[model samples]
Target: MADNKTVRFGLLGCIRFASKFVRTVTQSSNSVIVAISDPSLETAKTFAAANDLSPENVAVYGSYEELLNDANVDAVYLTMPVTQRGKWAVMTAEMKKHVLIEKPPALDATELDKIVEACERNGVQFMDGTIWLHHQRTVKIKETLFDSGLLGDVRHMYTTMTTPVPEQVLERLTKEAMGLAGAIGELGWYPIGAALWAMSYQMPISVRAMPSSVSTNSVGTILSCSASLQFGSTTTAIVHCSFLSQLSTDLAISGSKGSVQMNDYVIPYKEDTAWFEYTSGAKFVDMHTGWNVMPERVTFDCGGTEESQEAMMLREFTRLVEGIKRGDLEADHRWPEISRKTQLVVDALKKSVDIGCEVVHL
Candidate 1:
């Protein structure tokens, strides 16, 4: 068992994002980095050195298996490329170590299922590193908007995340067939996740690819795409993701009596303060002039000694791991359930695009 106050984490792979977690795990109150590993010994050594991780405290391993075998590690933070994450995640879970994986957890729902099953069978916690969901701002929204019924009945949601990538990078992604490297898998995950959250994690009944908006490369890799998710007869969500657009991470939700709009939902524009606009009880003037209420900016402060979303995520996962270790609680199933729901939608959207933009009923 790990320390009662802190969970020891092993870095499973030295991907680019691993650097952030190196700092985050150190900063978190309930977690500490105990090991680091990569396929190349030199790379692992270099990453540890670059991140200022001390060899005296943090063991460096030339191979992932060695890190997994480390008896001191109670959990693992897997930062491998998305395509390789599932297999390693399963391996980590099989070793009875809690696993916190990066976003887009698997190539598809099928693979994600295997990873989650492994975690469940081994009684290890499983969580995806989706930063925004861990933010206090998100919690505030859930309380004030949805839980309080300030937004009323959710009628529709619109989310988009797009950014322009270089031509060569897009070409390389297409050639290599990186799992979900296409706009849909890479960027669409954000919008789809937002939509599901707005809907209280309800599965959409159907998904339809907007063929008119779909863009593909020479090798038929999706460079950009738009899809519609039908939640019910009266509710729908429109999502657009792209690799060839101005940077945007917009989330808008309309309800019977109010609406919420977020321009930087994925990554807050500022680290210290994140804001969203909310308009409630809106109505037109007698003369059909400008409406009565305008969007009110709701700001969430994340400053002071408060942890970043990344660190909070680690702390939360570690708390769960600790509870399980003490036998006071079972591993939290909610995180893996959320990831599975997100992956299912991603699979449906990809299927719709592949089958000539047909409507896929879930």
Candidate 2:
């Protein structure tokens, strides 16, 4: 039986994203959001009230240190800005608190290594909060496409995830906020994860990317990219990602015998059904609803499962903490490998964009 002890969680930074996560933890059976800290007291109180957490149970700290010092917090969820995530992760690790940090855990590999070492030394579990990896859809896609051998030997993979930049997000795209590596950092990781997962983490043989100079910011608005990845004996893949225009969140893979396609790759909710196509000749045949194979399609009508990304992330974090307390290290080992490989591909893509040629040995 799973241990029934509640993992007391304190959320750092009452940012807009934390609200949904607070609600998820409140509803989770294995964990609770016992404390919250933000620079603004009013914001913290408002979040607590909206989430139905008692104001007394919610400690509004003026600074993160105040929250870190609290004895009641067994672990922490770090959802601050990408630039500050490494610092917070290191701090939390030094304090001996398990941490689930937001994506791009660090701006560079050096910072990621430091954060990893800190967590190791402190004897705490550390994970990058890449929510999609935790979702069941990823596993199902892998099994059906790779394990089932339904598609024969995989050859090509393409994914598109695009949406208009929110006004708030546009405002923060300045170099001062996210540096010159804009869209690649903010949006490229999703496709990177998908491609890597599909290839079963086989390092790509070569990668190339080109950013269209359409936006005013140094971070290009439109990115046209192609990666040549080799997996096993005869499997080769061409993968693409862009932040340029509106295309359905689509992922299509072609093999020697047949091809499989999935629409709505990034956010596949219960209400949203993904379209699948298999190529026979010049025509494509639509497969039955892909929901049965995609476990994330399993929905809850009540307080548990919802459409909030933040909620899904928090629930997964709670599961990780529970595993940690029980000395289960399997999940912990996989995180660093996946994170490092994802960053490596991102780096290769940037190099390809800069040199106007394919980057090899990524």
Query: Which residue runs of candidate 2 sit more than 4 Å off their true CA positions?
Result: 1-4, 166-172, 211-244, 269-316, 326-331, 356-360
Q: Report residue 27 deviation for candidate 2 (angstroms).
A: 1.6
The number of residue pairs in model 2 that clash at the backbone is: 0
* TM-scores for all predictions: 0.96, 0.80
Kindly provide the TM-score of model 1 when superposed on the true structure, using C-alpha atoms. 0.96
lDDT tens string, model 2, 119-179? 8788777778777665555555567656777667667777655656655556556655654
211-308 per-residue lDDT for model 1 (tens digits) = 89888887877889999999989999999999989999999999998999988998888777888889999999789989998789887777732556
Ten residues in a row with the worst lDDT in model 2?
A: 291-300
Q: Candidate 1 — which pairs collide?
A: none
Q: Give the candidate number with the greatest lDDT.
A: 1
User: What's every prediction's RMSD, in angstroms?
Assistant: 1.6, 5.3
State each candidate's clash count.
0, 0
